[model samples]
Target: MIRGCIKTITCGKKLSRNTKHSNTSNTGNSNRHLPVYAKVAYILGLRVSPSHRRMGIGLKLVHRMEAWFRDNGAEYSYMATENDNLASVKLFTDKCGYTKFRTPSILVNPVFAHRLTLSPKVKIIHLTPSQAETIYRRRFATTEFFPRDIDAVLNNKLSIGTFLAVPDSATWQGTDHFLSDPPKSWAILSIWNSKELFTLQVRGASRVKRTLAKTTRVVDKALPFLRLPSFPDFFRPFGFHFMYGIGGEGPEAVKMVKSLCDFAHNVAKERDCGAVVTEVSGQEPLRFGIPHWKMLSCPEDLWCIKRLGEDYSDGSVGDWTKSPPRISIFVDPREV
Candidate 1:
């Protein structure tokens, strides 16, 4: 039963997505944060009230939301669903033309949700709202999720929600995130009773490059990840290089992937996962060079770009001087 929204903006903040919601609320109220970037407007918690069943309310909402996102500055609008969900699958993929990302996984924990092994020098801790805003200015030049700007590693709120990374594994260090107020950046680990599925999706990616010392490792040493014994034929673990659109150089993106790999490993170990997977498409210099993890699925998931209207070209003057890795993460919809 998707209903009203409660959007908010920060003081002197450019766009207003710094909005928060309450248990009594249904959706975000404003589009202040949305007008700022080439964004994705996903209709979450889609449902049907008793009288609304089979009334096309869900489909109509999708059309309405898509229209709103387009009206606001979103270049692409998106959403996802499980393959078994016939109605959702048909609505988004078939009717709306939303493409499905590969390599989906569900993570679970009997006692807790994840594991963390953060570096001693780079202490992992949670951030307050003010701290998050400050960090955002440092991390992103433009185009951000407002909240995603903060370092999830130390944010306690991220943990209760979901985030963990193990950097400098030689030192046995890592970070974690929770989904509560003032999110958790240091909930070290959550030992699970059984195995959990670790999944990654590439919502967007482009080519990038940078220089790494020969001795410098790119993949983080910790993350609860393991390649499943068998992969479905249609699966193709896609990876994208995002440094291009974001305007960061290649080396920076490489460093980021290395950190993410470490986090992935820590997550796998905590939840007893079996593998880490990523698909590299159209190998460019940046897409190459990094260590190739095992490919659980094929590498033929062709990404077809369809344009509607307006200035489809991204405005960038400089070229990527170096090549780094391309990696985009997708989802881990908790069934809990």
Candidate 2:
């Protein structure tokens, strides 16, 4: 019988900078000017039988996976887990040499019985894949961990579409000239439908809670005008729409972002998605614009990463864990 198993996937390259240390022998100019990319891999679903605990099987599995990553030309490997998972934290950080890299929060907003209203003054424009790709590449190329294969992502069948929200008063420039002269206040986001790929279910709810949930759903359905807050049947298999590449600019950008989020919620309701979700860096400013429930969201999702091979001493490759949080992150929807 199989005692344990782990899964790994090679994500696309990410833009990163190499910190120049004085002790490095090379006198070449700082690698900052030249763009440096690291081929990244993600480890997930590591499992071991309870009876085999503390037998070093977990470490062996990690080592084997790391070897495979290096063989596949992965320069960096990372994994995400709940912040409270102490065992996972110890194994990856203490035993596997991975360091805490990023703390991004998973924001989840459930679809409600009543449709969310968008502002009359805010107009949302759907962008074609080509247009979306151009904007992402030009604006977010320098963002930390930006995927190199962004074109593929935009073209993927699961990607619904990318959208831009701007004040209706702004003169609408053609899509081609958007980069040159952007609107004064604007927000952009993309949606990925993951229902066909996978679904989620909630377990271990008490009988009383389940009854209360069912009653609430029934009442909400009967009286939607009341706008009672009712949750979907999370006890069963349910899928969600993921919003990614969320960003905005200008003083009124926050309102634009909120309008976009309302639009996404309405779309999710039409598609029968249980929730609309997105992950943003802990320090991201635009996060305030995204609407989510505190009880249903993860406030501190942990991502740990480590460099592969003997190039650990290379000063040209900066320590990603120590990178500043000010730079925005592009959460790859494919990884979801």
Candidate 3:
């Protein structure tokens, strides 16, 4: 058996610029951002065979992964896991010296729960990969694990497409119009179908929750026979749309988010998807108005970070140990 394995991808290094000069110069110390992203290695899919556990296999794998990251010029390494996974938590924090940091929530919405009407004042437009990348590079530049390869994500087989919702007052007729001058109160959404590529395994209380969800499925399946709209089978192992690349903050931010949610639900319904899912920092304002249920297995996911390489001892990176940490993470859709 392949006792354990870990996958890592290198993110960019020193991706900070002074807002005024747009340069990474130490000359202006006051203008330097505190959360300056240096080179980071994202570790994913660390696993050990149950039979091979407690033999230091997990620790050896982690040590090798960190070594690979350091050799590849990564100054920091990070990974995400569910809060309740005590084994993973211990391996990363106690054995690996990683610091526990961000807490982000994964939200799941049944596609057929309720129909939400979009405002007449807004128009939802489909976007090309290039168009979406242009907007995301500008908007999500500061977010963690934001893909440097937006075009790749947009072009992947799993990617359905990207969309934007903007005010009708902007008089936007097509996707190309935003290239010149994008609207102020606009929101971006990227939809990915995970049916063919992935599935979420229910565990613990979630197994019981899945049992309860069957009742809803029964009602949903009967709705059409009763002359009502019926929902797709959510208990099916796959068949979900993942929403990502979401960003917008205006006075109408909440409304824009709702419009996107409605639009996403429609997309999922058209494909007969089980449900739609997305994760955001718990503090993200977009969490409002979107329908979601608390999952026993996924109440909150943890993001852990650790420094590596010679710069690991840099004092400027700040002592994460000293303060109450608050992090806003943008989960990479490609990884999901």
Candidate 4:
């Protein structure tokens, strides 16, 4: 019987850069003394039947996947799981030699019937694909887990567009010298339409709870002005917009990030999406700028990584597990 299964994908590579060690837990420097870039693979959707528990099937599956990753030129392999998943934690860390690498938080905000109000002084400008690609390559190339095929991601059909949020007083100078003379306080983010790819449904809801949810939706629709806090109809398949490449600069950057999030919320509402979602590094200061409901947000999403190859061609990669936290992370929308 098919009791266990695992999947892997070569997402991209991490740049080799000198990183400072932080006192924070779980955030690490991905590359310390490695080559210019190291290829990386991601493992996901590992499953083993409950009846086959403790049979080592999960471990075997992970080993097989690691072999495949190594064969495909991946130097590092990583996977994500909830912090409370003890079984997964043990299998990956204790048995598989994977280290607890990063702890990023998944932030989710439901699309409310009422549109979010954007600051009158904030102006959002949509950037073309080429323009967006240039900015990402120049600014975030050194970021950990940054995809080498960023142009493909920006040009993908699912990507709605890349947007820049700045004060109305900021002037546009195109992409030519924007980076050198960037706005004092500005934020940028890209939106991916996950609806066309797949939808999510919340199963096993109590009958009473389901009825209450439906009732709330009805009331909110009838009286939109109430701006009632109502849950989306998760009993059915619903879609969401994922925001990625979220970062900013200057003192007002935090406010700009919030403005961009509000703008995304409105766009999701317009698309009839159930929610707007994003994931940011746990220690990321900008995390406070991304609005999310505490009830819907995940405090810590654990990511475990393992060095696939034993051959250290040019000295050790320096233990990434001991690396420090970075202020910003480039979350690949394709992963979502």
Per residue, candidate 2 scores C-alpha lDDT tens digits across 246-298 of 88778988889999999999899899889999999898888889999999999
**Candidate 2 at residue 251, lDDT?**
91
TM-scores of the models, in the given order? 0.37, 0.86, 0.78, 0.86
Write model 4 residue lDDT over 1-336, tens digit each, in one string.
Answer: 222212332222343433434333221222332223556777756888899889999888888888877777776778889999999999899999999888899999988877778999999999999999877776666666677788989999999999999899988788766776777888889999998899999999999999998888888888888878778887899999999988777899889999999999999999999999999988888888998888888989998888877674533435454566665567788777
Q: Which ten residues in a row have the lowest lDDT in candidate 3?
A: 1-10
Q: Which TM-score value belongs to model 2?
A: 0.86
For model 3, the stretches where C-alpha displacement exceeds 4 angstroms are 1-37, 113-117, 173-184, 201-215, 221-234, 312-328
- Count of backbone collisions within predicted model 3: 0
Model 1 agreement with the true structure over 1-336: per-residue lDDT tens digits? 553221211111233334433333222222223223233344544677868677778878767766766676555543434446677777666666666543222221111123444334222332344443333333232322222323332242322222222232212212112111112121121111112322333333332211221111122222224322221111224222111111112233444333444454455444434433333333322233223333333333322111223455442311111112233221211211
TM-score of 3: 0.78
Q: What lDDT tens digits, residue by residue, belong to model 3 across residues 1-336?
A: 212212332122243454545655422222233224455677767778889899998888888878877777776777888888899899899989998877888888766643445688888888888777766665565455565566778889888888888887877655445544557677778899886677654345466667666666567555634433333344455478888877776678768877888889888877867678888877877777466756422557888888775556554435433335333455667666
Reference-based lDDT, residue 269, model 1: 47
- Name the regions of candidate 2 deviating beyond 4 angstroms: 1-35, 312-317
Q: Which of candidates 3 and 4 is the stronger one according to lDDT? A: 4
**Error of model 2, residue 303, in angstroms:** 0.7
